[model samples]
Structure formats: structure tokens, C-alpha cells
Target: MPLNIDWRQILLHLFNFCILAIALYFLLYKPVKNFMAKRSARYEEEAAESAKLKAEAEELKKQYSDKLTNADAEIEAKRSEALHELHDYREKLVSEAEQEAGEIVEKAKKDASRERKKIIDGAGKEIADMVGAAAEKVVLGSTADAYDAFLNAAEKSIEKEENEIK
Candidate 1:
């Protein structure tokens, strides 16, 4: 051996290093690379699924928003319609009340007029009877003259009532 180094030992050590490198590549490197590739593929698939779900959620939100807007408009329209109906009902009630009051007033006037006529007729009859008695006392004769006076007085009362009516 030159300078205390052996060629056979050097060759053996190089062969051992090559074997260790090849074994480690087969055992550790191949498996780690396969795991990384499968993990990246799974993450990409998950991202695509998440995007699809987000789009669906956005669509649902838009639909809900539109429905809410339409509902608000519908509610406003219904409220206005109800107010109009209430106003119309109130007007109808007021007009009906006014009409009823007018009718009652007219009826009261008619009743009062009839009562006045009855009183006047009664007073006229009493006056005619008093005139008949006076004429009997004055004439001191047949009752036929008193009857004629009573008839005359009753005719005058009837004439007055007719003139007043005109």
C-alpha cells in the first residue's frame, strides 16, 4: 500500500455509499413526492367545490332580496288600499247620518204642524159654541137663530183658516 491507503478498501466504501443513496431514494423520496401530489389535487378539488357553493349561496341571497323587495311593495299597496277603503266607509257613514238627521227634522216639522192644526180646530169649535150661546141670550127666541149664528161664526173661522193657509 502506498502512503498507508488500500485500493480494495476504497472501492468497497464507494460501493456502500451508492447502495445507501439508491435505497434512500426508493424508500423516502418516491413516497413523499406521491403524498405531496395527492394532497395538492385534493386541495384543488376542494377549492373548486367551495367556489361552486359560494356561487349558489350568492344566487339564493339575490333571490331572497328580490322577494323581500316585492313583499315590501305589496305591503305598501295593501296599506294604501285599506286606507282608501276606510276613508270611503267613513264618508258613507257620515252621509248616511246626515241624511237620517234631515229625515228626522222633516218628520218633526210635519208632526208639529199637525198638532198646531188640531189645536186651532179645537179652539174654533169652542168659539163657535160660545157665539151660539151669546146669540141665544140676545134673541131669547127659537134655538134656530142661535144655530144660524153658530154656523155663521164657524164659516168665518173656516174662511180665516183658508186665508192663513194661502
Candidate 2:
């Protein structure tokens, strides 16, 4: 076996390694690096756009919240106003009904009093007519002797009724 390496073989292998490295840099390394750079840039742009969209969404949410709050307050105020109006209307209706009832009671009382007065007047007139009729009969009967006793009895009844009237 030869102890010393051949110089030509060593030089030839080194030359082949250099040529392969250069070819790989041009064919694979440069394109792969460019593709990686473009992909990274696209990712960065997407991230920036996503962040902007998120901020816009947050602003819209705040605006909607404010509108909702205002709407709730407005609805509450309107409800309160409606309730107050309803209460007032109910009170007014109750008051009017009470007033009408009072009027009806007063009218009924007046009518009862008038009716009672008419009944009392009619009773007095009836009593006077009955007494007058009894007195006339007694006076006519007094001409006969047997009727004289009946006249005295009738006179006594008249005195009793007069006392009762007093």
C-alpha cells in the first residue's frame, strides 16, 4: 500500500465540492430564502390588518353599548311617564265616580224626604175627612131618642181622636 495520498485526487474532490455548493445556492437556496421572506411578510401584513379590524370592532361595540344604554334610559323614562299618566287618569275617574255617587245619595235623600212629607200630608187630610164624616152622621142621628145615645157615644170618640191629634 502507498503511504502518500495522490495530489490530483484531492484537488479534484475539492473542486467538485465548490461547484456543487455554488449550483445549490443559485438553484435551491436563493429561491427558498425568497419564498420564506415573502411568506413572513404576508403573515406580518395579515397580523396588522387583523389588529386594525379588532380595534374597529371594539369601537363599534362601545358605540352600540352607548346606544343601548341611552335607549334603555329612554324606555324607562317613557314607561314612568305612562305609569304616571295612568295613575292620574285612574284617580280622576275614581274621583268622578265618587262625586257621582255622592250626588245620587243626596238626590235619593231629598226624594225620600219629599215622599215622606207627601205621605204625612195625605194621612192628615184623610184623618180630617174621616172626622168630618163621623161628626155629620152623629149630628143627623141625634134627632131620635135611640140615636141620642149613639150621638153621645160618637161625641166621646171624636174627643178621643182630637186628644190623640194634639
Candidate 3:
């Protein structure tokens, strides 16, 4: 009253402001806050899922890289094994060929020796028959001295034939 202040009007205006604040809190502020909270939670979940997917992709990539590295090693090992097998096969073939060749050479030598022996025996028999026939003819046609001379001549001819055959 002294400063022209009206207590009743001030109290009425304060009460009206309090009612408006409570209405706004329930009608607009609370719903907006809840919507924001839900949106933040959704974003966090999506971020976590994205991170998990990234980690899985990285793990898969690492596994594939390791497989590729192992593949190279496996390829090299297979190649080495194949080469070694080929080398061994070549050696085995060579050894077999050499053995076969040696056997053939040995057989050829035996055949040649057998043929030489047969030829020598045939020549010796032929020479003996010829000398006997000559001695018989000389004895039938002439005297004992002529027979001795014919035997000496036949002996000389046989020696010459043997030398020529050799």
C-alpha cells in the first residue's frame, strides 16, 4: 500500500504462471524428452551392431588372408613333391635301361663265342677228312715213300688253312 504494490494481483499472476509451467511440462517437455531418449538408445544400438559387423568382417578377412598364405605354401609343396617323383622316375627308367642293355651285351658276347667255337670245330673236322682222303688216294696209287710225301704235303696245307681262318 505504501509503494502502490498490489499483493492480490501479484499472487494471482504467480499462480497463473505456475499452472502454465506444469501444463507445458506434461504436454510438451516430457514427451519430447522421452522421444529424444528413445532416439539416442536406437542410435547406440545401431552403432554397436555396426561395430560388431565391422569386427566380423575383419575376422573373415584375416581368415581369408591366412588361407591364401597357406595356399601358396601348399602349392609349393605339391610342386616339390611332383618334381621329386619325376626325378625318381627318371632315375628308375635309366637304371632299368642300363640293366637291359648290359644283359643284351652279355648275351651277344656269349652267342659270338659259341659261333666261334662251332666254326673252329667244323674247320678242324673238314681238314682231318681231307687229309685222310688224300693219304688213302696216295697209298692206293703209289708206294710207301709217296704216301709219306703226300702226308707231309697234306699237313702243310692244313696248317695254311688254319692260319687263314684265324
- Pairwise TM-score winner, candidates 2 and 3: 3
lDDT of 3 by residue, 50-117 (tens): 99999999999999999999999999999999999999999999999999999999999998788778
Which lDDT values do the candidates have, in the order given? Answer: 0.86, 0.82, 0.85
Query: Candidate 3: where is the Cα deviation over 4 Å?
Result: 1-11, 121-166
Total clashes for model 1: 0
> Which rank order by lDDT, best down to worst?
1, 3, 2
C-alpha TM-scores of all predictions: 0.59, 0.58, 0.65
Candidate 2 Cα errors over 4 Å, as ranges: 1-16, 61-74, 120-166
Candidate 1 vs candidate 3, lDDT winner:
1
Cα RMSDs, all models: 7.5, 8.0, 6.3
- Candidate number achieving the greatest TM-score relative to the actual structure: 3
Pairs with steric clashes in candidate 2: none
> What is candidate 3's TM-score against the reference?
0.65
Colliding pairs, model 1: none
